[model samples]
Target: MSRVVWGACLLVASTAFVACADSGQTAAVARLASGEVAVSGTPEGIPAHAPARFEFGTEASATRVAMWDIDVRPDGEGLPPGSGSVAQGREVYNVYCVACHGPTGMEGPNDRLVDSEQWDDVPSTRTVGNYWPHATTLYDYIRKAMPQLTPGILSDDQVYAVIAYILWMNEIVPEDTVLDAETLPAVVMPARDKFVVDDRVGGTGPVR
Candidate 1:
């Protein structure tokens, strides 16, 4: 072949190789003019404008995805789109909580403490209905932490339903009412008025 033709052939091969290089380095979150992002683990000849997608190194990173599995306080900010009935709460309890808090909300040997007749006298010192001052506090605590291994797995409604179920078990409220921010804080507990604040120096503590 002629020298000129040979040179042209070599140039074409080089260009083809560059175009077919590994495609592993680009973030796949932002939208470029193309409307879609390309990601790769290796970038042998990828353009600089492209996003990165490497595994161990920052050469390529992924777009952040929101995590919604955290427990939320009863304030309503983190509440999921759900509402649970006392019956529904019972279901949740049976599946996730009853094992720990006992079958009938009583203080079983290793189960969670509750307001059953067995612990009526002992529970007034710490049970949900006998000790907790605000029903919202129960919701908040349970919403953020409960069911042992899987915390914050239940939706807001489920949390409320569970709270209501537990409360009903303690004879604090009916088993049909819904639990929410508005209704939660006001559902007075037997120990509601007995709670005193850290008022050793600051007058009589936070105003009611």
Candidate 2:
């Protein structure tokens, strides 16, 4: 008696089983011995038992892709069109940010956003103002993830406003300054010079 074994094969679009008969019972014996059996009805290289096409999900729409494509770079490349003042930022911060960051941004239940000491002072607590290397990153971070409870809930205007308020509290910007794509990136951070470039290439040792 000849034994028949069904071997599983995976096509680019579908999965199917290839029939293999041992004991020289059929033409598939030679191909099956080489682990490459040809199915009767399938196309040249495809298995006959496989479906013509199979896909897991629908294609993503342009609008859906755009929604997740929001990312701001250090040079302010991707900043959206919006403007926000310190006063407006204060309002937005009080409503949405004060609970986690506290009224002045110093007394925070979360990470502190303001620090009175200069970067050279080597402050024990690493606040945003004393440790952050770029001002543009503040806008990126707040816009993408903020408010503790709900992330990405703030509009562009609101995000700019909140950043302005935080910058003012840190003494990095004037209390009356308004933040926008044009002005926000140009605001130099206090700790900008503190960070060193990582020029080291691949190695097994420490980064230094």
Candidate 3:
């Protein structure tokens, strides 16, 4: 064949080969300009080793869900029916909290929980009395995760008592004060006014 004829034949053969190679493969997913995802594929497109149906464990039971849904709001929404006095709290703290939070919640091997002094914006100096904006949050946090070594082990009354002791140490409540669902949320935090609402909509201006 002539050189020109031979080159044309080679180009045609290459184009045909590419078309044949691409015929077996299909685009599984694609994104359109309008930000919508387009999917196109058959079961045959999946690998043979893939399972016919996936078993992602059993569905969670209502009782199991209720166990983990123990979040308490600032308004005492989820506070359980229990009470704790400062004296009772002291006992609970001595047994479970003293090791981590120190004897008086000041000499901590961990974060200090009882400082009524002014916070100098230093993170290390921030404590429950000086920095925390909500007293209920303290109860919520401790009940959810506390004692460091064994979290969620304290009973509701014990949790309340321990919180009372810490608050007493912080001078937020009187030594004889008893905290329960009604009284706990009513306890005002000292730093409550320090925090403001972040009303910035969408990714607008600087973070509040």
TM-scores for all candidates: the values are 0.53, 0.66, 0.64
**Candidate 1, residues 1-208: lDDT per residue as tens digits?**
2578556655654453343332221222112212354564557787777666446544322232125334343233334555666788888888987766678877554544465333433443466756766566666577667766898787778887888888888887786777665666557677654543222333566663
The C-alpha lDDT values of all candidates are 0.61, 0.76, 0.78
Instruction: Flag the better candidate by lDDT, 1 or 3.
Output: 3
Candidate 2 collision pairs: none
After superposition, which runs of candidate 2 have C-alpha atoms over 4 Å from their true positions? 1-65, 199-207
lDDT of model 3 at position 72: 78
Lowest summed-lDDT stretch of 10 residues in model 3?
Answer: 25-34
> What is the C-alpha local distance difference test score of candidate 3?
0.78
Worst 10 residues of 1 by lDDT: 24-33
Q: Which of candidates 2 and 3 reaches a greater TM-score? A: 2
- Could you tell me which 10 consecutive residues in candidate 2 have the lowest summed lDDT? 8-17
Task: Please give the TM-score that candidate 3 achieves against the real structure.
Answer: 0.64
Query: Which model is ahead, 1 or 3, in terms of TM-score?
Result: 3
Model 2 C-alpha lDDT per residue in residues 6-63, reported as the tens digit of each score: 2221231121112222212344333444557556465677576767766768988878
> How do these models rank on lDDT, best leading?
3, 2, 1
